[model samples]
Every structure is written in structure tokens, then in C-alpha cells.
Target: MLRYSNRSIFGIMEGATVFYTVESNNVTNLHQFNQELRNLFDRLRIRAASDGSSRKFAAGNSTGPYPATIYALMQCTPDLSKQDCDDCLVRVLGDIPITCYGKEGGSVVAPSCFLRYGISLFFEPTDDTLQSMGPPPQAVLPPESNGANATIINEKKRNASRIATIMVVAIISFLILIIYICIYLRVMRKPIGNSETTDVSSADSLQFDLGTIRVATNNFSDANKLGQGGFGAVYKGRLYNGQDVAVKRLSKNSEQGNTEFKNEVLLVAKLQHRNLVRLLGFCLEGSERILIYEFLPNKSLDYFIFDPTKRAQLDWARRYKIIVGIARGLLYLHQDSQLCIIHRDLKPSNVLLDAELNPKISDFGMASLFVLDQSQGNTRRIVGTYGYMAPEYASHGKFSVKTDVFSFGVLVLEIVSGQKNGRFQIGENTGHLLSYAWENWRKRTSSNIIDPIFKGGSTTEMLRCIHIGLLCVQENIADRPTMASAVLMLNTDSLTLPFPTRPGFFMNKFSESYKESSEFIQASANEASVTDPYPR
Candidate 1:
């Protein structure tokens, strides 16, 4: 009965606001506060996961410093069953710290659930709430017996005691049997390696044999190859059913290829959204590790947006759709997916275009998952392409949801200008796209950055997007808007945008240092860029 379309269904769910911190009191002992919050989330997770999970909602408070208690309320969408609700809510609530940790009051809203916590009450305490639910009922007690009835009761009681003793013995015997069975199974299963094979058992039904894929791509002939990246080559294929698919064959020589291959196979399998590339199946036999995806005939956004001839075909209307589509897709990854994932590598080439020109995010080899309430993560082994990497992530290896915002900002500017952000020039200004956009906006000549392909499109929209892109790339991570907010800024015209300060790598001219910092990222770059492309 559901007349669902990918774009339509995606539009409906992409707007869900996942996690947010309220702008209230800033707790001084952030570490202690976070510890208490995690304890509370675990409690709720268990309560929601158990039987009688219909309520799928609970509220409680945890003690911090004296007179400083954190009051929290968590609830999942009523329609979701117990397990799904528990999973969705716990994941959504865990990102609160990254969104707003020190704040006294904040809320996270998702399509499945909404969580709010602070030093105040956001919802009325229900006596029948989930936390109050308890164990099985007892049989009604009989009225007190006396005289002749007392004698009969004593006789019955003696018999009842005998039956109860037998029942207890039988229950204990069953428990022992169950325990022995569990131990035996545990020992038998302990030898499985904690690697891709173990993690992807759930994907067994979807795995395609190498021979099947070989036939589909005719042994991965060069002519069938779509494009090559740092990790592997993608080939276009057709199954026996006549369904088109994209096959990614990773190079064995690459050091991180196996890890990335396994990660994509596991991570992409759980994510189902309109803007994401669907993983039809995977092939992992012997040394070969291949991933299959829905074939996108139009190639990638970079193939067109950076090409002069193809650029003209994407007028402002189409460009704007691409921008919005990218935003919604990022929103799904950051807030709406099964896990809080940071797509460390986000660039034009990673965005593929379908026949309808709708964008589907691709290449998840560099992505990372953030545990509940964990905002930013550090990495000594820096990854992601240059030009789009956030300053914190690129330099010190700190990345969070805001990192994606910065990349999205770079993408917006690239889409609007139909030029690569790494080497962009406007008249006398020869610097990175961010510098050019900032200078033009400040000089009241922002229109100079707009692509000539859009002659009659709305100037206001283009200007607004440029403004948003700048906000995303601000040197200060806090200044960047969350994807939910970014989507609002793009779709809702009335929302006002804050002025962006000097972005990272801001410059007046094409200095050698600037060139080094703004080098165009080739498809062959590793997980992260170690230095400027044109290092002086």
C-alpha cells in the first residue's frame, strides 16, 4: 500500500533532527557529567530492550555534584517495536555530548526517537513509566482461615509445600542443563577469528561468488572499468537477471585495502537510504575481496561538475538539487543511520550521479564510527583527501560531525562555481575557492564566483549557498552548523546565517604556502593527506 519512491521517502525521513545539546548551564566537571550520562543510557537501554517493551520510553535522573542532578527523558517513536526502538534511541542519545556536552539542557530528535536531558524536567513523570514496570504478578491471597477452616488449611499447606519443593528441584536441574549447553557452544565457537569473516556472517546470503561476478564483467575487462581510486578499480557489470551493478575490485598491494574492503562490506550493508549507494552484495573468496553496488550510469559528480561541457548541462536548478541531495545524504550518515558514522573522506568524486541526476554517496573505505556520546575522535594515521579535510582533522587528526560539514561546504562552493576548490582563480585573486568566495562576498562581488552556466537562476540562492559553504569551513569547529541545521539553511529561505570569520588557509593571493595547502586531491591519494599537494 505504500507508494514509496526513493527521493520521496528520503525527503520525508532526512529532515529528522537527531541529537542536539541545549544552550543552558555549562557543567564544569564535563568528564564526571559524561560518565553519569552513560550510566543512565545503559540503564535505559536494558529497560527498553526487555519484554513489555511496548512503552519503549523511560525517564530518570542521575546524581552528579551536590544539588546538581542531570534529569533526562528518553523515548522512541511509538510505532517501532521494542528492539528497534531501543537500538535507535540509544544510538541517537549517545551523540548528545558531541552535539552539546557541557550544556545543562539539550535535546536530540530522530525519526525513531527523541532524547532530552539537563538539570530540569522536560516531560511529566508518568507513574506507569517504563522504569516503574516490574516482575510477574502473585496469586491473590485467600482470606484468613480460623477454626474448622484452619485445620483444612493446615493439611493443604503441608501438601503444597511438598509440591513446591519438587518444582524447585526440577527448575534447578533445567538451569544446570541450560548452563552446560551454553558453555559447550561457547567453547566450540571460540576459534572463529575476530575479523571480516566473523563480522560478515550476516551477509552470507548476499555474497556473490567470484565466478558469477567474472561472468558479469567478462573477467573485469578494462573496457568495463568505470573509474579507479586509491584503493581499487570499479567495473560496471550486469547480472544474469539483467540488473546493472558496479563491482569494486580492491588492489591487494594497497596496505589498507583489505581493512577498507571489509569495512565497506560491513558498514554499507546496514545503511539503506535514497542518497547512499546500495551494496547489492560482496565477493570474498581466497585473496580476492570485491564489493558490488548498484551501477550509476552518470558516473560521479566530479565527472560532470568539473567538465566545462558537462557543467553547462547542470544549470542552477540541477546544481541546487545536487547540493540538497548531498546535504540530505550526509544528514543520514551523521544522524539517521544505524550508527553515528563520520565519512572522513567526502569529495565530489565520492558523490555519484544516477540517471535522474540524483546523487548517491560512494566510497566508505575511510569512514569511522563514533560510539555513543563520542563527538570527536583522533587518529595518528591521518586519512581523507586534501582540500576538503577540516583543519583540526588534517593537522591534529581530530574529527567529528563538523568535519563533514567542512567538507560539505567545500562541495557547495565547488558545485556553485563548477570549478575545483584546490585551484580556483577569480580575476586578480588566485587562491583556493574558499579564499575567493570569502573575498568576493566581502567585496560585494560574490556573484563573480557563480558559474556562467547559470545565467537566469536565482542569484539569492547561489549567494546563500556560498554563505553556507563558508560557515561550514570556518576555522573554529563550533562555528560550523550541524547537518540538520545546514539542511534547514538550504531548504528554508527565511533562516538567517551567521557571518563566517577568517576560514582556515584564508589568503589574499596565491602564495606558495597557499598552493601547497590547496593542492587538488587526486583520486589516488591515501586515506589522509600528509602534506600540501604543492609543498614549498
Candidate 2:
């Protein structure tokens, strides 16, 4: 509960009297002047509405003879309402300064009424009245009341101190609990032998804000969607500082897939090369696992080399650069880097191109890390793209650096012929690009193997790339040329090309299977189509 008090004073400065008097048209209109006077006093009633209080006020004036003037003012306590409002004002007005001996000036100011007058105009304009007030008289109390008030004030101070102390303790307790929970989760979440951090640069290097990532990809809108893969959809994003980025967000339901995710973050963090796609930063917030990479404008090699219209833009010169770029990238991954890495899913689709059509080996999702001295490894699951998989790797689950060489060989042939390795079909060849290329090479009609669209391209250069491709697709892993040697042979004119032997696991009956498979796919598609039958 709260209490309030108020007071006001009024006075006038005068010298001489004026002879003019205010004259209204009718005597009954005197109520109009009284209403205006009441309205003037109403302003003080609504003054303290903000503090949830009610008020009322009233006032009156009298003009005597001898060219005298009259002034009147009125106000009410803020804690009063409408009826109380008018009643309080009327009471104050009834006790006007009639008792004060009339001389030249006088004033009447109570808890409500406050008026003043003189012989001349005491205020600025005739229609306007001054709304000024003096400060209220300070409240004073008896000794006993003062003692009780001091005690109550002291009690309030003590209560405030106690509340502040409790609030501080509660805040500290909450922070400590949060720290402990974080530590427990960190310890329990990590897989055995996993490192706490992938980089030694700084603890905050990989940290990304939620708002920052949202703004980068335009809140992950459909327009910024790059592509979808096994992990999740990739988004093309732009940061606040205008840095273009590719964001890979992992799917939550992907169970045993994060093994490669962790491998890539740790491996790429330590290694840096122009051929390898750069990892700008990473994020692990709540359920979000995002890997931010430098944006590659040209997209994947398959997007262009396999496309009918886009493939036209890639002449022999551009295609050769892409092939050599991929070789250099693979060479760095296999031998130059500290970790001996084998990209298990090396294919045309996995090789991304930059602005100048330079190939950068990407998609380290199925990558395997080998020790420096280790040469090979075998996996039972055998996870890889069907056509690009080497014969030994696909059938026996044996893979090495040479496994990637086999895929590279298939990519080379596809680039030259403008066809997919798996889509090759004639009579029996269905899942065989090497067999088709080798058969065309042996028939002395290798010119038929050149892409019909590249009819204007040099046959000599085309034959050279085809020959190198055959060498890389040999049956034995040892027979395949290393990426470094392949790059050197392609670049140098002085090196004598070696004769390629019988190709790896070439099935003579592929042409027959190809025909059967095509018929089956066609039949399946027809069965799936909704066709309306008409009676003949």
C-alpha cells in the first residue's frame, strides 16, 4: 500500500486596473463558462492515471466593481474518482478567498482549489489560464510514528539483501551443473581412441554459430540445394564476409556412417593441397553435424562429361587438364601426404571441378587411411560404386591404391567416348566399359570408340589417352600404373608407351547379358506405367 500528498500556491503581479469586461450573448450561457472552467480543472484529475489513482477538482471566480478582475484555480487528490472528483472540487471552490480582505490581489489554494487575481490580466492570453503549482509540503510524523517507519525501512533493506544473495547462489549453481553435464557427455559420446579435437590450431576454429549458418545458406532454402548423397543434402552457402561455401549436413538416421565423417575431419584438417578440396570449418551443435567446404563452381566431372550439351564445352584440352588434375590429386593422397589415404569411391562423379576446370578429389565419405608403410587393406562389406569398382575389389573385397587406378581408367575411357561405364550395352556387355573399350581397341576400329560429337578432335591424342586407360585397367593390381607414373607418362612426350595386356576379368558373355538386362528393365518400366487399355 502507498500514500500521497500535494499542495499548490498562486499569486499575481499587478500595477494598474483595466476597464474592459468579458460579455457573453446570453445569461443562460453562464453555464457554458462554468463548464469550461470545470473542463480546465479536469486536467489535474487525470494527472496520475499512470500510477493507478483517481481524482476530482472544481473551481469558481468572482469579478467585483472598481474595474477589478478575478482568477480561480482548482485541483484534486490523484487517488479520487469521478464523483469524488467533482465533489472535492466543489468543496474547495465553496471556500474561496472571500475571507481574505479584498485589496488589489488575492489567492485561494487548498488541497484542491488554487486561484489568483489582480486588477490587470494576470495570465498570458484571455482564453488561457496558468497551470503552475508549488511543491507539496513534506510529510512529518510524531516520534512514535517516525520510530515505526525507521524500523520498517530497516526490515525492507534486510529482505532485499537476502533476496540478492539467494539469486547469486542460484545462478552459480546452475552454471556449475551445466559444466559438469557437458564434461560427462563429452567423455561418454566419443568413440574409443577418437581425439578430442581434429585440429591443433584453436578450440574455437571449428565452432559455428546457428544464426551464422542459417544466414549463409539462406536458411537452407531449396534454391541453395546443391545435391543429395548417402550422408545428406549439400547446400551452397555464402557467409557474411562473402565467402562461398558448400555445407554437408549429415542425416540423423545414418547409423554406422560417422566413422568416415570423423576420419575426414581429422585427416583433412592436417593435410593441405590445391588438388584436395579444402575443409573450411565444421560444426557439431545439438543434432546438427555440418562440414563446410570451399565452393567449387564447376561442380562434379560427371555432371559435365556425362551430360550431352555440357560435354561439348569440354574439348580435348579441357578434358586432358581434368585427367591430369585428378592424377595429381590422387598422387598426393596416396604418397605425398603424411597419411597414406585410399579414396575407396574414386569415380568421375566424386571428382569436383573448380572455377578454371581444375579437378579436386572430394567425397571422402568412403575413404580409408593406411599407415605410411602399409600398402593394402581388405574389407568384407565391399562398399563402392558398381562400375568403377576394380575386378579384384568388387569380387574379392581386396583394395589398395591400385583400386583407385582401375576407377581412373574407367573415367578416362568414359571422358574420351562420352559414355557411362555401367551404361555400355550392345549384345552381351552390360556392366563392362573396359571390355567394350578393349574390344574396340583390338578390332583396329578404335576410331569408332571416339565420341561422335568430338569428330573434329585429333585422333592421335584420343588414341594415346585410350591406350593409357587400358594399361590402368589390368587384371593384376601390380600390373596397374601408379597415379604418379600415369601423370608423368601423360605429360611427357619422350616416355615410350608400354603395350597393354589382356584386360582384367573381361566376360565374353557380357553382350548377351546386356540384351537380357535391357529387356528386363523395359518390361519393369512398362509394368509400372499406368496405361489405359482400349477394346479392339
For this target, which candidate reaches the highest lDDT against the unseen true structure?
1
The C-alpha TM-scores of every prediction are 0.60, 0.57
Return the lDDT, model 1, position 121: 54
Lowest lDDT sum, 10 consecutive residues, model 1, at: 527-536
Tens-digit lDDT track of model 1 for 1-536: 01223453322222134224467677777557767776776776666555676656676777545357777766654456666666676556544533554666777656556667777654444333324333325444456645567678567766665664476346434544554565477667654653223243344545677766786898999999888767678899876535789998976664545444555466667779899888887887778878789999898898898887888778888889999999998898878876666777889998999999999988754334344455567878777787788889878988778888999999999999887877666555566788888888888888999887786767999999999998998999888899999999999999888898878767656477765655454323553222110001
lDDT of 2 by residue, 4-89 (tens): 22532212111111111222222233234433333433444344222343222222334323233344433344444545544544
Q: Rate the local accuracy (lDDT) of all candidates.
A: 0.71, 0.60
Clash count, one per candidate: 7, 10
What's the lDDT for candidate 2?
0.60
